[model samples]
Target chain A: MGQEMSKIEEAKNLTQNQILEELEEQLRVEEIEEQPDTIKTEEMVINFGPQHPSAHGVFRALFHVNGEIVTKIEPMIGYLHRCFEKIAENRTYAQFVPFTDRMDYVSSMHNNWAYVLTVEKLAGIQVPERAEYIRVIVGELQRIASHLLFLSTAGLEAGAVTPLQYYFDERERILNLFEKVCGARLTYNYMKIGGVRADLPDGWLEETLSFVNRLKKTIVDYDRLLLGNYIFKKRMKGAGKISAETALAQGLTGPPLRSTGVAYDVRKSDPYSVYPRMDFEMVVRFQGDNYDRVVIRSEEIKQSLRIIEQAIEQIPDGPILAPGLPKDIRPPVGEAFGHIESSRGDLGYFIVSDGSLKPYRLKIQGPSFANLQGFPAMAEGSYFADVVLTLGTLDPVFGEVDR
Target chain B: MLTSGQLLEFANTNGIPIWVLDASIALLLSLAVFAICGLGVIVLVYMERKVAADFQLRWGPMHVGWRGTLQLIADAIKLISKEDIFPKNADPWIFRLAPTVMFLAAFVGLMVIPIGPKLVVQDLNIGLIYALAIPSIGVAGIIMAGFGSYNKYAMLGSMRSAAQMVSYEVPRALSIIGVVMIAGSAKLSAIVNAQSVWYVFLQPIGFVVFLVASLAEINRVPFDLPETESELVNGYHTEYSGMRFMFFLFAEYIAMMAASALTVVLFLGGWHGPGPAYLAPLWFLIKVFAVIYVMMWVRWTLPRFRIDQVMDLGWKVLLPLALLNILITGIIMLL
Candidate 1:
């Protein structure tokens, strides 16, 4: 082994002890050679991709893998760089909802609502009671759809093809509902500035209720298929574990954070959009591993159902959209960062208005971005397969992560 | 020319043309077995999807012909027309031959397998040994594809597979030995005949050990560490594209089916049915599909094991259990 090491070192033009030092020097040089001369690691970097299938979009993970477990990851951005924030800045408050559809295309309706809710909060706009209830129902349903995707994609990347279609079979129904409500399927820009774009389609409530009813049985089936699976347990349990403190320090929110035993849900901790009035338990689990992340999502889907059920019952007989909010009205020159508990994590919008028709600047605080910060920490010293599972459990949508 | 042992004189009395069987008849028989095995792979894949749907609470592949029964046929067509790309620097000969060798090795193993009463391709007296031996030929295909592709990841993958398959074979064969001893025949039909009661009930530990090791042998998860994507990037066939990739996939699914059938034959009883002997192969088919379904379920349900853990499972858990089964079986046979 020593002879082999020496031979490798000789090939690299270095001694055994000099190898680490030379590597560090190379890293420093690579960092300094950047366009702006920024310091960075140059440690045998491999570009995970701009068009790679596994990167899950035009996402690139610049990895410094010492063997299998990545030692450093400088995630390069600006691939699916659609300039969404810039587009949002120029569009009217109502027009901006469509652009929000571009944010996370998997659960576009939830992104639409998150943006609209932020704008509504800024303008002191009170949506009709029915709209609030309708919003929660749609949002929760979108949460299930989003997490289902996370679960399936995670499974697919991990070599589990059956679950992707199994989850997609149910997902197709939800997309059908979205298509019925709005003319679009993937990007439902249905949530307007003040409320929803229109009232729920006739029998939409009944259809949603039926879906909710079936989803209960479906969750049970998911548990039977996956929860008690010995392989699933072995793969996920104690893999990619993050302490509650580590999660909080990294600004991780939503299920990933909650899975670490921190019950800080935006719905429960800082309620918005009639969530305070809605009755639902804040689903949580203690072990901050990939298994816990998965289970938390499972529980959250059930909780989302509970909330949706209540929202359907409590929906008032009134207009879905408020009548008075102007289509182009802009807020005064001030900055407001509105954060919401999106299905992935804490999705937020930071708006800087110049007291004009359009805001001067807008920033999207995609939860997936912050959630990715926990990845390197979780991945270090883990097996190659576990890295895939960990990333899957983190549920980082490259759209949000790169945005 | 018949070598008879105690209670084996029936073979000489039957005067079967055990040697030099007609080439055309043998070819026809081999072709028939091949067809059955191919059909079994297709049906198993579809049934696996359906079972997965049942587990995941949804409908699966319902849009194709007649509740998606022809989905596999459609998939086969799609695979046929696909362009098979050879990598720029890949070894042309080996790359082209890899999938064929893999499929051939697995397919040939089917010949020795006893399907039903008097319905075997060639019931070699060394049928059990032949059944175990043919699959190890697949290791050459894996290594050839891995090295021939000249992809670093594929090389690593094939290397890991070479090590894993060889290591796991020890326990896999040992586990089956318990049943072979009890049956007292290397002939597959005789083994099936001996299973008046399934070895699964009598040799439960052996059954479990064999099942685990067989999964490792087929490179299914939690033993799918060789193809760990996050590590070696699609393992051995990373450079293989289009139809070549499909061929690799075909081999994998076929191997999954074949391994499951072998497990059924060895432990679950090959063709002993509740009804007539002619229905035995159907029973065997059902058992094999059930095993395949469980394999798929496991693939979706669990994560891949680390190479070290996989090695440990093969040596530490399975090997010991297999040895224990042998020891106990020996003691019981002595008593």
Candidate 2:
């Protein structure tokens, strides 16, 4: 039996150089056979990004521009890839929760929550009601922060500066609130396997409620300053319009999908945590254009504020962590998928545990990676400026996409 | 009066020969114009940053001098010392010559504006028209710079510049006809004097068309498609750096100053406020700064338009409104 198992392993094993050589040979054959330079006479291939000001991250796009219009665009990713999936295979289940923090650093609470949610599902562990409520509060706040960032940077890409600064001020307040709660502003590794790291300190919830009340009124300032301005409307409306069919076909979710008049929010469709107990509406816009994308996000900030308020009131006094779980986190052989409505879109974490301390395999389906599939279509016939507008509206966080 | 003729006469009486006195007066006026152009830009740069900070809620340039008043001067020194680059196969002569044209276009346009009753420079016969024509020279330099840069972004930017400048010039030139008709001459000083109630009240429609077209003429935001930051990078000046870049910047601010001055002269009644006759130019300066402030306000508030949208605003909206103003002015004159 030992000899047979060794023979099977040896048959499957391939040297690193052998694998690289195979890829090199395929690339060489495809490069010649495909005639990559056939249309060099009429079209100009512009290499955009990876290092561009508004590519948002290290996402490169190869565009064939005819005059100011983009005739074709092929997005080339992987410049920021560090293989978060492969890293999960080596790290223990409980130890790898912090890795999700760096995956989408913009809203680290969502990343933290998603990984823990999956682990709890896979191990059949239960989280207390107080922990769920805390998760909901921080998750909603993180969504607000992420959307505010999206709106501000989108405004900047269209050549407006004041709105960006004004929005950053609001985000600073949220960051301060997060700091007071967890002693960490960004990439808060506060979520654990079955509960939160700690309970809320004194007066933090009241401060949060006051901030939400203030933001509810102040959010209109963005519209008065940027969205309602005629020039902004002209520049962004109908600039990179995507139909609902095209967006759904590309497996788009989050604001990009919601902007197309779909009400498919993960928090609603597949209710999780304390979300089902909360009272808030999912924001949606009819037109799937650049304008709708921004409008949806700006309106969604109000909804997040609503959710945060409800979570503060309904949170029950109970144990923060569940009991009767091994510290080592060795789950019996099983697979499970956990998803949450992340800021960018539907973020799902899949893990396969083979009755070991570490996971056998892990996969993350990031919304940004899926949302980026719709980019070439949006940018195909638009003006050069509209390309940046479209990318800004999609709000792809490269941290999640390349992870 | 401090007119050029009086200055020459004063020089002649002060023991200078007639020929020498005439040349001296001309040289002094030229020197004064250059000085105002240079110094005014420094102040404008500082004011714009300070004002932009106020609008955006940020502290802008608080380190160099008191309130960073000398920030631009330090910047000037930095720019002068940096390596002046030229792209491979770029036309050296045109690349070197382009900024001079951009600078002189605004500089020479300053010759005809009457800053005060007696502080007129050349006071040409067709002063308003000459001012209109002079800045068109910047178009040529822009195109040359774009062609000479050997970069595709520069080429597209210059192409957009050529199209935008040519299209906007029609409505801009046409709008001035209403003011000329009211003043009964194309002379800018005569236009200023004709406005008993600051023609903005009499010809409000003309003033509106003029403000819109003039904003487009100077490439202000919403009309700044040629230099659309998100689109074409830096537009026509994408490849420039060091002092050559500074010259382009200088040209932009000077054009702004000259345009705002012309707006004051045409509609605000140049130097006509209640004040000492010699100190009246201060009123002109105030009104011009007011117009510049409004321009900055519009710049900060509005996002940039696409090239097609800019072209549409020029041809479809501004041109017809300009012609309508002229038609109404003619009817009023006939009645």
Candidate 3:
């Protein structure tokens, strides 16, 4: 065992005893399960999802299960691949904003901001005061919408059917607010190269303030329905405990990483776009388990509400777009990476401009893709039902994962 | 209240021919049961959907009929009319026989279920035992479907049902024994009559054990690990479609009705409510629906348990609890 630990240490380049302890614990579990039973049961190879009800969307997980515990995990993804990066290279710099909307469709506002924030940074276009505030309001509202969905799906995948309805009801109202703002429900191409497509509609800020007040109550409703539910809590707590080291090593961002006691939110740590002005707390938990992740999302929803409240009050009136910004957005021949603390994680976009109308190459630093690297690690020894909850807690939108 | 036998006697005394009378009695009982099953399914399915919608904060099926009253009928027509697909490499005999076994188990259990004192199809002395044993027959059908389908998911689901059913049967039956002991008969009608103070008060622990165990036996969540739709994608009945799957669905709902009916008899005073003597059947159905409501509420509210955790719950917690209930009953009886 000591020799095996040393070999692993040599391979992994780790000096700490934590890895060895985790390995030892895994071995103990294996030994316990392998202890001879009256009727021996062989391991079954099971293909879960791509079409699975609880798989968020289009995630295929091939697992070898001993009764219910997942022994081997081979996660088969790319079922929702739309080739966003490839599309980015083909289209003009400003034309690809719609494509970004589809990447994380639940939080399309954030996706648009991530992409445009990069383009704005790359081309050195100054977003007007009103545009930044609108961006914050829209982005934070989208975050609330995204987290609301996360809460619903997490509860649903864990077998509670009621929370999804409540969450969706709340989400629909947010979407209504979104529609009022942009005249689009899902994929809003509302963000342009330098600024928002338009200013908030008449009384939009007042309406948004009212929405924040309403959302405070709805958020509590979600907490009551799901957070305090015994079966939900029992199913979530200690189900998918991922360590902070593995999370960081996998380049994880967002709630999946933050749940492991690391408050590495790009918005806070690496402040971007109007986030410095919006004062709010970053939610974090120590366990990095399913419960912690769920709690983190719930807490973040509250913080987002706070930010929205502040944004609405502090938002200034000015031009919704940068003045003197050319319509034909062609950045200089240079590479620039722009990232923001999106609802999911540090949603980043990297673009290489060739001094042409279109970008030469574009790379999407999607959080879902990065966070999904920790899935096989988390699901390795957990129960089959626990695997569903783990996937829910991880909350990988196939739009982002397979983009 | 004319029993089936008395109705036969009346037919014989009347100018009706012997063959016609015999056929009529049999046909009447069969038709009556079929009507109950069909109508029960329609009402219960609608109730379940509405209840689930209410729980989830959405309006259930509301387009087909007034509030989608005809939704189940449409579903039935579709299911019945749909193609009966036999999976390639399926063991055709067992696959075909599976739904029948499940359907008949549920249907036959209805024979012993007493809606009123004389409303039972065949109130055999061993009605309670018969009710218990009949449901176990469905387990074989579950295993057969799992085995015969040759689909890994179906097999996993069936195997889960096998393990779950076997483990839960002990507690399920044990909990019922307290009721049977109090009644001094396995006859379900007698058991109902025996409840003067309503055995639920005397055997609260027994009622809890019975409810929990029966939920496991019927594959309700958090005991529904076998047919976990999220993990197993419809469980043992995954490969089934059209009418065959409908049979499986019918069996599930019928079994739920049976469990509820049995609970009403054993715990709540059966068919004894605040109404006229003739309203007993209505009261009976109302109680059954109430029980079904709770089960469905639990189904939508609670998450599924891990397989091992479910086993631990059944054996370590439920089994011992059931046994303790029996011990307490015995002690109280002696005192």
- Give the candidate number with the greatest lDDT: 2
The RMSD of every model to the true structure, in order and in angstroms, is 9.8, 13.1, 11.6
Candidate 1 docking classification: acceptable
Model 1: colliding residue pairs? A27-A42, A31-A40, A231-B302, A232-B302
The C-alpha TM-scores of every prediction are 0.82, 0.91, 0.91
**Candidate 2 structure quality by residue, lDDT tens digits, B110-189:** 99999988578888889999999998888888998898988777888888888988998998889879889988998888
lDDT (Cα, tens digit) per residue for candidate 3, span A1-403: 9999989877776645667888999999888788567457677898888887777889988889887678889998889998889988889887898888888888899889988989888899888888888888888888888898988888777777788888888889889988998899999899987888977889878888887899898788679878898867778889888999999988888999999988798888999777888778888889989999999988988898898888888888888888888778889989899999888898888989999999999998889989999998887998877887788788788899999
Score residue A75 of candidate 3 by CA lDDT: 91
**lDDT by residue (tens digit), candidate 1, A247-361:** 9999887889999999888888888889988878998899899889988888888888899898888888998888876657777777777878899878888887787887778
In model 1, the fraction of reference contacts reproduced equals 0.36
lDDT of 1: 0.80
What TM-score does model 2 score on chain A?
0.89
Clashes of 1: 4
lDDT score for residue A123 of model 2: 90
* Candidate 2 chain A lowest-lDDT run of ten: A8-17
The per-model lDDT (C-alpha) reads: 0.80, 0.88, 0.87
lDDT for each residue of candidate 3 in B26-110, tens digit (9 for 90 to 100): 8889889989887898888999999998887789999998989999989999999999999999999999999999888888888
Please tell me which predicted candidate would have the highest DockQ against the true structure: 3
* Worst 10 contiguous positions by lDDT, candidate 1 chain A: A37-46
